[model samples]
Target: MEASEIFENEDFLWRLVRHLPENSDRNRFSLVCQRFRRALLPFRTKFLFNCERYETGDKVIYLQFDPEKPEVEVTPIEWTGLLPMLQACAQTFPTIVSLSIMGLWSGSSSLPTNGLSSVLLHPRFAHLSSLKISFFKAGVDDNFVRLISTACCNLTYLNLRHCCPRLSDQALHSLAGGCTRLQFLKLRGHDRGPNTISDFGIERLLSSCTRLTDLRLCVGFNQVTGWGVRAGHALTCVVMENLNHLESNALSQGLQGKRLKRLSLHGAARLGEIERLVVERCAAEVVEELNLSGRMELKDGGLERIARECRRLRVLELRGVHGVTEEGWKALARHAEALEDLDVRDCYFFREDCLRALRENCQNLRHLLISSYFFLQQRSLETFCNARPSVTVKVYHREKDYVVDERVGLSGRPLGSRLGRRPTLYKDPVRCYKVRRFGYPWFEFLPFELVSLGIV
Candidate 1:
């Protein structure tokens, strides 16, 4: 090879090496051949690193590191191993655009929040566009917010899950003020203290993250209620200066019109003024996948209003909407032709025909989960499969294997004259168990592959 070409090739290897995490793959590469090893010599200072796998590429990049790894003494040894690597990756790839730190609670039950100081604050992460920090116990405290603000300055997509003691309005303030570039944000399992997340935090978030195209915020738990109760304050905690915070009444005041393609709100039972606040205000038709499973009460016309407003709805979940009946579900399903996923578990007061109506009408349905004790019956199993040929049915019958589809058929004549005179329930000769005593019932285990009806 030409000397110039070799030099260019070496430079390229160095660039790729800088992006690799400190993991087994890099270790294997380092030992492959002397020339390869020498090419990787620049990164020899890295004692440990971690690998992050992306589903699309099928390639696992090892992010490498070095220097004195911080002593987060209280942090579990296994999880602590990645902290130094993360810090090093941030330093080396200052422009590293997409990064995610997930399952931080690995190797331990408790979340380690100490070693997170300079890791995110480093200028290297300033240009990071996509960031996801999962399983870390974070609070809305100044230090934590500072880390997020300083590090994810250019973030466009962010997912914060199960983090912190309480993520308050202050944290939302920092994110909205700083990460104005955000387009998609998900805040799941982020507690703002017990029954306390005022609209201040959500309003700031909605206001600041204006460019947000997808937003999922699960605010309250099962036990809170009312307009000012639990996460209820989140919706009313409106700020008009921010167009996104324009309340229903202030709709014409700000950016006046907007829409969301996907929305999921849980713990609706905590909302105090459910009838007026939730039903009247949230009348947007942009949702494609809507799950209202966490709310216990759906007032008289709540579900009907949703069916009327969310006309573009596709995937609807009314798992805990007990107030909804077969008629109400049918009303909602009428406009939901594009619907693909429907969960109707424990809405028992409704008739079984409601599901039949769905099977006949919602032909595009794919996944249907029904409770064992609800309106689900053995007869409807075949109807379901026949209606949506692409659908997979999961019945919850524990004691009986209700096989409605025919398995084996009676073909050839009986073997003997007297004993086999009459045709009996087709039994598998291989599965027929022998009896040691007289009058012991002849039993056989049916093959799961049997195609004909066994017993329903």
Candidate 2:
């Protein structure tokens, strides 16, 4: 068969396009011909629209290729044009299952809520399973939530971030009544708003959304004292930030019997006796990732309890926690055999003996981030680098100055001199070969360099 004939076949094109992993690649492939575009249309399921305002007050809208990565194609549009764009998207991508719209600015112009509602409530989006609306200045309220609940009956994932100031407990009540099949929900409030959704709304939502597995509430939900979360029986992942003592205790008490896999309690600075209660009651076993960053009341006893209990822990973040001593770290190294990623940044009490203990015991450890507030001897760092060359050690000194030491070769030599600069113990211990490759030609470029670098 001729090459042109093979390329013209729609079935062949559809098979190839379906296997293309990334949306960017599929989009590029569709540009080949009309036949390729038609073949790729069935698999196009996601639509992303972002409108952001820079410091200079210029508003730009664009489509984001990947949500996890920062790659965008800017298409500037007026505030009034948002409705038409959404309407066009609904008409063009009738089979889209996931939709994300971000208006990340506090502009003087009000949002066209009527137009937005018309497009969202359109029959073309009846099967939409995921919807994310973020950072709108105004117009999102209980009525809008009710409209979404009434329209998107199949929605399983909903994320609202800094978008709803007028949203209150009544919105939650509406969602609970209409969106009973929701599995994941994230509500991040604006910093300036009053606490609109309280425990009553949370309790109602959890009780109604029986299949909810992952729930995250970040700033602005100050009224949520953790009592509302106790109703979630199927929750496996939970992230709550900037919680007070009462909230932490309530959350710990609520999560007593649930088997969570990932839990992060960021900025729970006042978790004193509640820290132990959290470990014993909820996160004793089965939890894989735990982040207790900025919990000032965490002590050696709490550390010991976590090490002994959470044997399945793979990722541990203890940033800004200074109460743990060498004894607690030793206990952690002895017990946490499955530990792979550990971040002890801003921990001033971390010592050389703890590093040695971790280097000797943690076989699966691959990433270690420590602060340079208390310097570890160069000899100890070199020893650690040589022994566990697979592990990438990052010593964070300040916001801008940090060292990343990655494994160089089978010899396990630290890539310090690769940067053509001397390695200093406190200032710069080692530089990554990935960063060095851009400016230097002496270092041989390896295809696997990025994977080995482990840049977070």
Candidate 3:
């Protein structure tokens, strides 16, 4: 067989180096065939090797450099270590569109001063549309922002979360100027300067980016509310109106029906009287994604109004909020049957009754994130699951204290296992959050000597 013929054969290529322990083994295999060589290209784009498994079976790799021993074992993708691979990937996968730098494996303490510049300045990124960067503390200097704006002219989607002290109104202005064709812009929990994105700044961006469909504005700021609740501030009322005016202008200019689909105002606690703002300018029918996190000032009626108006809402995130009761959830369930994702985390007074109501009405519910303090009404949960077999619940453990069930006389699981039982995958949020490094025990709180309740 010709060497090129072997490399081109897709069927046998994966099997060739499938059992090879080392990633380097594939390089040697590639020389054997052209198909193998082509196969190696994809692997280079995404590396699956674990650092721990370098010597043994199924090793979990660590991307980040850790000095102090961590509480639990972690498999984080270190961005710096994978720079060479990323460059190769960029070269090989020039047409690659979406890029998400997420998880512990894909983050850096500081923005890659030179590395990022290359990517943004490269002609490759100019054609790209979507980019997501999170958990990085980088000074988004003027030069860096300019570089991005100059390169990412065609970008339509952008998400920058926890990338603080770098982004400012100047940066946003640059992006607005360059990415005139932007469709989605998410600035989550990022600290921009005072008046960085004021009414004028917002008007500038919104008017320019007529194609924007989704916008998320979350800014963390200290404020002494008249009511004494210290919550973060979001886009000002003036800015929101400016946005509305900009949208209206865009519609007048050329865009039809205002293509704006989703608008998120996360962690804007200081923005009092959200209801009036929503009622006054925001076209509830067009807005699909509404995120109100840690905004204690918002009342139940405000939420009710939103449900009544925003009939197209599909994703609603209400995290760390108050004043929303069971009735509010019920109201949303009744109105927004299209709601697929509902996050009610850290709402102190949020009751189990709301969950039951959600199960009964929101048939389209797919993703529900609740706080640890929130408990699933066992009967309601079972009934809901029975009714909607596809629903997956992701509950974050907040409460450790438990009381014995009055009827069953025991807590958690029932007295004994059923005839045919299955192993449940229960994760410990406490331990998971505490884990600093790898080699940590999976079940830290469980008694090692406890006998199994299974019918073994």
Ranking by lDDT: 2, 3, 1
- Candidate 3 regions exceeding 4 Å error are 1-111, 119-126, 188-197, 220-260, 352-356, 371-377, 387-390, 399-456
**Of candidates 2 and 1, the better by TM-score:** 2
Assess candidate 1 and give its TM-score to the true structure: 0.61
Better of 1 and 3 by lDDT: 3
Question: After best superposition, candidate 2 residue 388: deviation in angstroms?
Answer: 1.4
Candidate 2 clash pair list: none
Residue-by-residue lDDT tens digits, candidate 3, 241-321 = 112112222212222223335444454435556654454445566666777666677777888888888877888878888
Write one digit per residue (lDDT tens) for candidate 2, span 1-456: 333443456444453332233555544555433533343233222211221132223444433322222122223333445565555555555355666776646532355266567877877678778888776767377888999899988889999877766678999999899889899998877666664788789888999999999998887666777767788889998888764434556766677787889888887546566456556767567889998888778888888778788889999999988878778788889999999999998887788899999998999999898865425655677678878877878765442233444433221223232333333322121332323322332222222332332221
TM-score of 3: 0.59
In order, what lDDT does every prediction score? Answer: 0.48, 0.66, 0.50
Candidate 1 lDDT score at position 231: 26
- List per-candidate RMSD values in Å: 12.9, 8.4, 11.5
